[model samples]
Every structure is written in structure tokens, then in C-alpha cells.
Target: MEPNDQPAPLLEGRFEGRNDFIQLVRDALGVAAQAGWRELILSDSNFYDWPLGERAVIDSLNAWARGGRQLTLLAKSYDEVVRRHPRFVAWRATWGHIIQCRACPNADALDVPSMIWSSDWVMQRLDPVRSVGVAGTEAGRRVAARELLREWIENKSAPGFASTTLGL
Candidate 1:
């Protein structure tokens, strides 16, 4: 590994496609609960297949929230699910944090306040001076985070809500 190659501390954005998103959401829930991840930054692509994604996303959020962690959604704007889903909307209104990505169009009308993930949030949170020096060695944090998430999925006590399909 190059001395300068390091994994960045990520607050990732993902699209919903097939089972990958499902797995990711499940893993993210575990990571948030076990590793102290504070926010989940999402992109507009998250809405591509609305219902499945919503089911997975909402379940994950509820699971994490019930376990006492926070969820932050970055949105293009308000949509039916965000506006009508009793659980998510309530969370956003009272418990969850939101960030609007205005560049995504229609994001300004989102009903919640959200921090921009790419430019403002991660940049500010990651210490460039410190990370630059130890970027290569600091990757252990990411590996550990992934392991914690995987552990949660394997634990039957915290099994994520089942998807209708076989999760095949």
C-alpha cells in the first residue's frame, strides 16, 4: 500500500438496486449501533425504486433508533414517503436529522434541515492535517467498522426486518 493511500472516514450515499442496498442498510444499522456512526448520508438515487428502498430504509432507521442511534437523510426534496410515512416523518420531525442537497433540485422544499454531506460535513469533520500523516495506518478503523456491522447481521437477536423476497 502506498504510504499516502488511506481510507477516508465515510458518510456514504447509495442507490437502491437489487439486494445490495438491502445488505448495505442492514450493515449500516449494525455499524451505527455498534461503532457509533452518527449519520447516514443518502443520495437521490436512493429513491429509484421507492417502495423497496423505503421499506428497507425505514426498517433500518427504526431498528437503529430503537437502539438509540441517530439517522440523517440527505434529500433532493420532500416526497410522498418522506411526507406521509408516519414513522420516518415523525423521526425527521422530532428525532432524526436531515440535510438538503439543493444542487439535486427540489431539495430546498424538503421539510427538514440537513447538513450538506460532501462539502460541508465530512470536510469539516475529517482533520486533514492529522489524517494526512497517518492515512495508511488508519484504515483499521474502517475494517473494524465493517466487522462490527457484519457481526450485527449474524446475530439473530438483531436480525433486520425480513424482505418479502428470499433476500436472494
Candidate 2:
């Protein structure tokens, strides 16, 4: 069945606390899939707190996967991710063809804003430690968010987090 155009639900908020932020991340993914956002981008330091390993998150990602869709993830290091998020690693391996995973190493030590960016929406943890930030669909927010991360995604980051490691 063709997916309906009806959006999932509004998820915009200025969230505080870890649980609230996690809920926003989860809700945003569901909305992103439902709305059929074409490009999904996530930038984080290490993704220590994201729910990427959860089954529900994977389900939403599956729904969102299709031709012409692209997903990108930027991080400083994936060591913590590898240690903490096995499910997401598996998912990434399977979906590697559709994902672009990159790293900011060395002097590119930008304080990568922890955020989720879709074609029409944005959610960022402005103070990640406090789990406090904003999520919205306004054009200004979307544009500013895009501009803030586009440079790193395009120029500063290097290929990272291999979908499948090879050794012999």
C-alpha cells in the first residue's frame, strides 16, 4: 500500500532532561518516516545516548528506507557506539548502501551539535549534557541547522565507521 501523506504528528518542543530528549528523538524518527522526508542526517559526538539500538527505531528506519532516500551520520569517534549500540551497528551494516557515516577527527574537533535533521524538520540538543534543546519545522530553523552542519558533512569529515570491517 502506498504510504499516506498524512504526517505522523507534531513533535516540536524545547526539551529538557535525558528521558525527554530521548522521547523527542524517538518521536521525531516516527514523524520523519511518516512524512517521507527524503534526507535524514544525524550529528553527534559519540551517540552515547541515542536510541539507535532500539527495535522501534529500526522499524521506523525500515519504513523510511526507499530509493532516492539518503541517511547520514557524523561523529567524532564510533568507539563508544561500537561498545554500546550493537543493534544499530547491525542495522548500519545492512543499510550501508543507503547511509553515509563519517567522522570528525584531529583538529576538526568541532563541537558537533547533537541533532537530527530531516527534509523539513530539525531537532538539536543545544546543551547535550543537560539534554536541553529545540525541535521545529520552521524554515529559518531548518535552514540554519542545515548551514551549521553542511560544511562538516561535506568538507571536514572523513570516511568512518566502516559498515563491515575486513581483516585477515
Which candidate number would show the highest lDDT if scored against the true structure? 2
TM-score of each: 0.38, 0.92
Tens-digit lDDT string for candidate 1 (44-146): 3123223323555555555445544433343343354444554655544444333222223322333212221211122111221121111111345445433
Q: Rate the local accuracy (lDDT) of all candidates.
A: 0.34, 0.85
lDDT of 1 at 85: 54
RMSD of candidate 1 to true structure, Å: 15.6
For residue 164, give model 2's deviation from the true position in Å: 0.5
RMSD values, in order shown: 15.6, 1.9
Q: Which candidate gets the maximum TM-score versus the true structure?
A: 2
Window of ten residues with lowest summed lDDT in model 2: 1-10
Tens digits of per-residue lDDT for model 2 on 58-150? 888888886678999999888888998898899889889999998987533338779998768899888988888998889999989998889
